[model samples]
Target chain A: MVQAYILIQTEVGKASTVADIIGKIPGVMQAEDVTGPYDVIVRAQADTVDALGRLVVAKVQQVEGITRTLTCPVVHL
Target chain B: MVQAYILIQTEVGKASTVADIIGKIPGVMQAEDVTGPYDVIVRAQADTVDALGRLVVAKVQQVEGITRTLTCPVVHL
Candidate 1:
């Protein structure tokens, strides 16, 4: 499986809600509300890199209040 | 006392704008807008953990359009 760390930004005061919602999505193992440069941190997985990209674009990014996201794929090296 | 990677998210199409604004903040070493889970990533530091927190909360967070941030302090292990 391909694994990635998805960093998310939400509208101010909307982080906790966004994290909670993302945590329920399939393939998303965990989504936490955090304070710093990014509001939500998510760990997710898919069958391949392309699948991961699809999930990010098709599912995660579709969530409202999620202004932006960065997908850092885990590299074995 | 600390150095960190700040991952940021902004309203769609706001990534470049956010990065530009944050790059000018004091103590911000670098701010780059990238495609992924984080729209903008920043490297910064302060004398102590508290100062780092203060910089994040008082300064970085004050930037308009910055919805959330996550401070990943580099750890020596």
Candidate 2:
């Protein structure tokens, strides 16, 4: 499985809503709202890196109020 | 002196509130709500790395409904 952390930025007052919507997505293990530059942090897994990328670019990014996302795939040394 | 970004995730319907409160905390330079894997992203600084830790552990982490935090200190090469 490929695990990754995706950092999300939402609109001025839409963090929680965005997180809630994202948590219900497939492959998303956990989604939460927090304080910082990012409004939501998600830990997710997929069968391959390409799948993870597609998930981020297609599903996660389509949510309303989401402005930007940075995907950080877990790397094992 | 050190600079870092704190990624946070909170419970459902709590991202905006958490970010609002964290923005008022001392040393927090910026706090904004976002969508994706993390709910909030905060950029801040202190006189030292240890101080930054205290800020995160004592102040940022103290917010109610916050589930977890990941601190990423910016390293200069």
Candidate 3:
């Protein structure tokens, strides 16, 4: 299983709505509105890194109000 | 309480050691070795944003082997 944390920056005043929509996307475990450099934090999982990338780019990024996304994949060492 | 996720980048081959050391820090809730852009992912908490900043700059960043850190504070909407 591949898990990642997606840091998102949204348009001003759009954080809450963006997060709400992201939370319902398949593979997204949780999406929460947040304050700071990032406006939303997301936890998502997929079967592989490639699939994870697709989820972020094809699904998460397609959401309105999102400006940027930085996906940090969880790794075990 | 101010909670944040700290995405960390470390020198090559230092991810495990960095995570180990960071896990012992007082304010750090958890630290794990991870691959991709970040070498380690940390969860930490403080009483205020300023205190959180101090925890990152003074404590988390002080550890050797860390190259970069991006703090993403959690916000409730």
- The candidate scoring highest on lDDT is 3
Stretch of 10 with least lDDT, candidate 1 chain B: B61-70
- Per-residue lDDT of candidate 2, residues B33-77 (tens digit): 665677877778898989999999999999998999888765432
TM-score of chain B of each: 0.93, 0.96, 0.98
Local accuracy by lDDT, each model: 0.85, 0.82, 0.90
TM of each candidate vs. truth: 0.54, 0.54, 0.82
TM-score of chain A of each: 0.96, 0.96, 0.98
Per-residue accuracy of model 3 over B1-77 as CA lDDT, tens digit each? 99988989999989999999999999999897766677898989999999999999999999999999999888777
- Which lDDT value does model 3 have at A63? 97
Better of 2 and 3 by DockQ: 3
Give stretches of model 3 more than 4 Å off.
none
Model 3 quality (TM-score): 0.82
What is the alpha-carbon lDDT of model 2 when measured against the actual structure? Answer: 0.82
Query: For residues B3-77, what per-residue lDDT tens digits would candidate 1 score against the true structure?
Result: 899888777888888888889998999999888887899999998877886787678777778766778888889
- In the range A18-73, model 3's lDDT, one tens digit per residue, is 99999999999989776668899898999999999999999999999999998888
- What is each candidate's DockQ, to 2 decimals? 0.27, 0.05, 0.58
Residue by residue across A1-77, what tens digits does model 2's lDDT show? 88777878899888888888999999998777756566777778899989999999899999999999888765432
For model 2, what fraction of the real interface contacts is kept?
0.00
